[model samples]
Target: MIKALIIDDEPLARDIIKSYLKDNIDLKVLAECSNGFEGVKAINDLKPDLVFLDIQMPKINGFEMLEMIDEPPHIIFSTAFDNFALKAFEANAADYLLKPYSKERFLEALEKATQKINSNAPIATQKIIKDHQESVEILDRIVVRFGNKIHIIGLETIRYIQAQDDYVDIYTHEGKYLKQITMKYLEAHLPTDKFVRTHRSFIVNIEFIDKIEVYDKESYVLHLKEGQKISVSRSGYSRLKEVLSF
Candidate 1:
């Protein structure tokens, strides 16, 4: 049987989804969540195979919530917004069901999700997050969950980003925090004028730069406040020079 989770802020919407799933004997509704924070906890605890997710929720939206999870379930997005449909599909969502959709449409989406789940296909969550980042408006803050606590890191507070396999480490005045995201995604969304990729694995906030020093003929290093240093590749150094005009 396919274990399912419903994550929608509206009580009516959650009930509607539950009603639609009643006919599908192969799927079982395991939990219902009103907001993204609750959804995250439910997903982590329940480990459901499929999720009916709503985009706009309190505290953090659907996309931000997904970023917190290392492995997200097969997601069928139900949202009133149409602008995110193309990006959602590109991110490999199991399906996208616009709000006020008919039962027939919901069945169709369910069927699609069921087929993928039965075949044991991996959900393209990372790709989906990256695609969503590129399509959406510039984010002013990043929402992350550390244990049971949710933290919102303002963009201005970020000092640098370092790549860590499938994740990235966000550094600030307070400390470093891990986020399951990619360099390409960060580069696409972050403001170009303020942050620059100074190496294959490092993107630094130019606002915190104290100086740029020569490491050798082909290499350079960035000096920041508190005596912190970051290596700068030849290409990265060139890009930094072009952006900083120095």
Candidate 2:
């Protein structure tokens, strides 16, 4: 039997999917989750073969939850929004089921998922996540996963960000957390008024800046309020000067 999980914030939506699946003896409903937090826990614990995922959920969105997983199951996205259709396909989702869809559409998506599963196809999602991140005009917060725990860091609390190979280290007053993301994406998404890419490897929050010291004729160093110093390149200094107007 094909084990599946339904993750949606609405109770009615879950009920509808369940109702449609009653006749599909080949598939089994493993669990139902109301929010992304429960969805993450269920997905990790149950390890379902297929997931009916909703894009917008409490705590974290579906895309953010997917990032936390090492190997995500074949996904059939079910959401009210049509704007995410391109992104869902970019992620190579099994199918995109718009809300209020008929049972026939659900079955069609299920058939596609079954074929992929039987063929042992892998889900490639990195590009889609990157695409989704870039589509956002501004970032108010970031989600990071450590073991089984998930942390949501607001932009206001972020002291700085440092690139570490393919991952980036996000530093806040509370602590530092490593996330698998690109600095370029963050540089483009983060609020320009509050954050500045002070160097190729560093992006600093202006509120955290204590002082700026001239390291040389072409470069400088930033002293944050927490006493951590960051190196600034000539181009970075120019950008900083434009933002700080100094």
Candidate 3:
């Protein structure tokens, strides 16, 4: 079901929109806002998929409200004015329903909005997941024991790793530190294509790699293409060749 938020200045207008939404089996009116300020706040907090937005209001207008939110929802402009039709479409609005439009017209606009929502759902879900994962501060930094005192190391600074028995030694542009985690478990969170395990004990950052150092074997030694010398196993080398189309 598509969660919807309604924003209109008039109470009767709100009632009319609510009645129309009642017939839409897929729509649920999650919240109601009388003005654009409240609408912006509600949208940011609730993150609804569909918004029934009125163009003209007391404070901020519909267009301005869309500008304020970090991630705007599928907007269906509910307005009395038809002059803004060209501008609304230019702004990539999902759909628009003119005031006093019949149920048939509203259904048409609603269906159009639904199709837009469905088409973009996958991309939007990915963004949400990425944002959630990146924003999580749980493992953003790690504490390293430097002689007697502990040092804080940023996770983003890590460039590579080599497994040493039960502990993994981390290599970064800054320096190296030992962390207690298996290579298999750590690979799950990192981008696999970007970071590859060349040996049973090592995982290197591909971006920092300088060049592939070919020795006795023809296998592509991940020279991090940068300056860092990281080895690539025969199996890992084959996978990288296919991935890079080499």
The candidate that achieves the highest TM-score relative to the unseen native structure = 2
Choose 1 or 2, whichever is better by lDDT: 2
Q: Which candidate comes out best when scored by lDDT?
A: 2
Over 136-189, each residue of candidate 1 has an lDDT whose tens digit, in order, gives 766678887766877789889999999999889999888888887789878877
Model 1: residues >4 Å from true position, as ranges? 22-26, 90-93, 119-127, 134-139
TM-score of each: 0.83, 0.94, 0.47
- The candidates, ranked best first by TM-score, are 2, 1, 3
TM-score of 1: 0.83
* Local lDDT at 57 for model 3: 79
| Cα-lDDT of candidate 1 | 0.86
Pairwise TM-score winner, candidates 2 and 3: 2
Candidate 2, residues 1-246, lDDT tens digits: the string is: 889999999999999999999998999999999988888899899999999988889878998888888777888888798475466465554478888899999888889889888888776455566567766778888999876799889889999999999999999988899999888889988989999999999999999999999999989999999899999999999999999999
Q: lDDT of model 1 at residue 227? A: 77
**TM-score (C-alpha) between model 2 and the true structure:** 0.94
For all candidates in order, the CA lDDT equals: 0.86, 0.87, 0.67
